[model samples]
Target: MERTLSSDLAFENNSAAQASMPLRALSTLMLWQRRLSSRRQLARLDSRLLADAGISESQRYEELGKPFWR
Candidate 1:
């Protein structure tokens, strides 16, 4: 009975993890997508807007050069 209970607990833990894995992956993907979109927008900003945002040309270039994961 004790062994059965232990196995049941383990199964529940594994099931929960499995269910959450895809959700976590989707969340990560969405986060990267947003980052990429924002970076692209940043790269397209005019000098005036960039200045307004306090971002220098070098800083914009540096940010644009980074991967979304970074």
Candidate 2:
């Protein structure tokens, strides 16, 4: 009975771990997608808008140059 209970617990733990993997990947992908979208929007900003946001053209260019993964 004890061995059976322990095995059941181990299996449950393994299942939880496996289930979390896809969630973690999805979270990362969403984060990267958001970053990409934000960068694209930033690229569309006019000079006045950039200044209003307190971001310089150089800073915007630098940020745009970065990969979404970063």
lDDT of each: 0.94, 0.97
Query: Which stretch of 10 consecutive residues in model 2 shows the poorest summed lDDT?
Result: 1-10
Model 2: per-residue Cα lDDT at residue 28: 100
Q: How far is candidate 1 from the true structure (C-alpha RMSD, Å)?
A: 2.4
TM-score of each: 0.88, 0.83
The parts of candidate 1 lying over 4 Å away from their true place are 1-5
| Model 1 accuracy (lDDT, Cα) | 0.94
Lowest lDDT sum, 10 consecutive residues, model 1, at 1-10
Clash counts for all predictions: 0, 0
Model 2 scores what on Cα lDDT? 0.97
